[model samples]
Each structure stands twice: as structure tokens, then as C-alpha cells.
Target: MGNLYLARHCKTAWNLEHRIQGRTDIPLCEIGIEEAKMNVGFLEALKISKIYSSPLTRGRQTATIYATALEVPYETRDGLLEMDMGEWEGKTALELSALKPSLYLQWIEDPRNVPLVPGSKEDVFTAQRRILSTILAIYKENDEEKNVLVIIHKYICSLLRCALQGLELNHFKKEIIETTLPQNLSIVSSQVIEKCLSNC
Candidate 1:
């Protein structure tokens, strides 16, 4: 019954510009690097045994910092990758709203019902399933470990939060979880993971 610490990657240049970074492989900015370094103290207290990260650069960079600081091993997993935004990859929310109002509105109001954007690989529901399965697998693999760290993107974090709260994907925006996580680290207790697996 290991605990999973899900962390959002630090800021990036695109993050500063408010761009959608889905599968874009953007690196962390100076501030992001500093933020990761700053977080090491708190992470160290958790005594994480190992790290799993998304293959994207941002997630990798954050994981590297934590791994180096905590002296723990880290590996990248494709299943932990960000949702593919396709044509919407580099656009900001405001830009998307202006360019495709109906689709953007659907995304905001009910992500589960939003049509896949042109060139998008998976819709919100698909992304949710992928993340949930990935997390469950990781939890099972590290059952003996006391704590495990997983570095991922904001969208995936939001999806996991929705699932952990026993809410549907459509509740993403409507719930208190918000579209963005409050901080870098989110603690997913083993009990909650067990509950999620039963319902999954």
C-alpha cells in the first residue's frame, strides 16, 4: 500500500505565455527550475523511493531535479504523457475560445462532451482512462515502496483528481478541483487508490 505523490511539472515558457502545452515537449523556464529546487525540501520529507515521469521534457526536467536531490531512481513512462491537443497545442484558452467558440465552450462546460479537435489523438474520456490505468499499474508495481513520485502535466492531474473524488469527467470544470491544481504536489493515499481500483 504505497502512497503516490502526483506532481505537476514546473512552469515553462509556454506556461508563462498561457499556451496549451499538450505533448509539446517544452522545457522548464528558469523560474520553473528554481521552483523544483525549492520543492525538494518538502519532497525530501516525504522520503520518496523512486520516480515515474511523463516522457515530455517538462516532466523529465522536474523529475531530474527531484531525483538528483533525493538521490532516487527515475524512469519515464509514455502512459504518463500529456493529453494530445493536436491543432490546439500552442493556442491559449482565450485564443481557442475566439477561434472555435462552440467547441471551446463545450470543453469548458462539459469536457466529456467536447468534440475532438482536429488532429487530436484522444478525447478527454480517453485521456482519463489512460491516466487512471497508468496510475493503477504504477501503484501496484510499487506496493512495497513507502512513497512514489509521479511527475505529469496539469490536465492529467485534473483528470486524476476528478476520478479520486468519484466524479465523472464532465465534472472537471464544475468541481472544486478546478482546471488547474493548487500546487505542484498532490498526495494520493493508498486507501483512495484501492477504492479507485474497486470502482474502476
Candidate 2:
């Protein structure tokens, strides 16, 4: 199987403040830029042939640094956008828990059911199966030993991991993924995960 690297986007204002960026279009904060630079190391090692990113600013900026380092122009793909958090765009965790209690509870209980903000839900990679189809299509059309990086959101990265491993989605939690992925920079690939699992 070919190698695919799914890297979470760098920090954002919301990321720093613990807000749910969802499909929000906020630029990266100061720390996010440094984090992006550090994370670009692994990607540069891969010698990525083509880079793809969410059309949103955060995602694009995250990948652009890597693209510049790799001397390749990054490509934007709408399919790879982060999930739309709707009203939760820039609300902090504490704020949401306190102010939008019921909605927040529902969101924590189940994200799919929450009413999405306009022009947000349509751009999400919510399910693993859907992402698999999209990624596989990209692979099928561009067959080669190419390494690619898709800079996306934190949760979407987990969902893609779930899809690659065929893990159950509902029972899947984001915290588990947080601990598993590299702290500032992480690499996600079907082959790498499989090898790690096999060794385990």
C-alpha cells in the first residue's frame, strides 16, 4: 500500500484558547507558527511529491510551511476540510459548558446530531468510510510511491485513523487519539499504524 500522511493543522487562536475551531476560518496564533515549523521536519523527510490541505486558512497555512520547505506548491482540496462546529466556532470549552449547556451536552454526547453552522457541515470528513472513499479515489487516480500530506483538523485526523483501521467510530474518543499522536507534530499512515499494531 502507498503511504499517506495526515497531519493535524498547526495551532490557531481558538486552538490556543481551547476553542472549537470546527470550520471556523481563524488564522494561526504565534505559537501555531512555531509548531508548524517544528512539525514540518517529519514531512520534509518524507520528500512529499504533492501536498493537499483544507481550503480554510488554518489548514492551508499549516501545509504551506511544509510545502515551502519541500519546494512544492501546496494543493487545496475542499474534501479535506475540518468539520463545521456551527455555533461552537470560537467558544472556549469552559464557556460552552457554562453558557450553552444543553447544546454543549448534546455536542459532547454526539457531534453528528448537533445543528451545523451554515456552510460548515458540507465540508466535513465526519465518517471514516467517506474519508476512505475520498482518499482512495485520490490514490487510485494518482498511483505511485508518492508521499502526500493532508493538513486537517485534530478530530478529522482521528476519524481518518479510525477509517484506516476500520475502528468503531461511536465508541471512539478524541482524547485517546491525542495521547497517541505526536505531541506537536504527528504522522498518520495506514502502513505505519498497521506495523505498529502488529508489533503490539
Which residue pairs clash within candidate 1?
none
Model 1 residue 113 CA deviation in Å: 1.9
TM-score per candidate: 0.86, 0.74
Span of ten consecutive residues with least summed lDDT in model 2:
178-187
lDDT of 1 by residue, 42-109 (tens): 88777789988998999899999999999999999999998888888898988877863457667766
After superposition, the stretches of candidate 1 with alpha carbons farther than 4 Å from their true spots are 174-200
Model 1 residue 135 CA deviation (Å) reads 0.6
lDDT by residue (tens digit), candidate 2, 67-183: 888888678877676666666677786887786346665555444445343445542334444455556555554446766666766666656665555554443354224321132
Best by lDDT: 1
Worst 10 residues of 1 by lDDT: 176-185
Write down the lDDT of every candidate, Cα atoms only.
0.77, 0.62
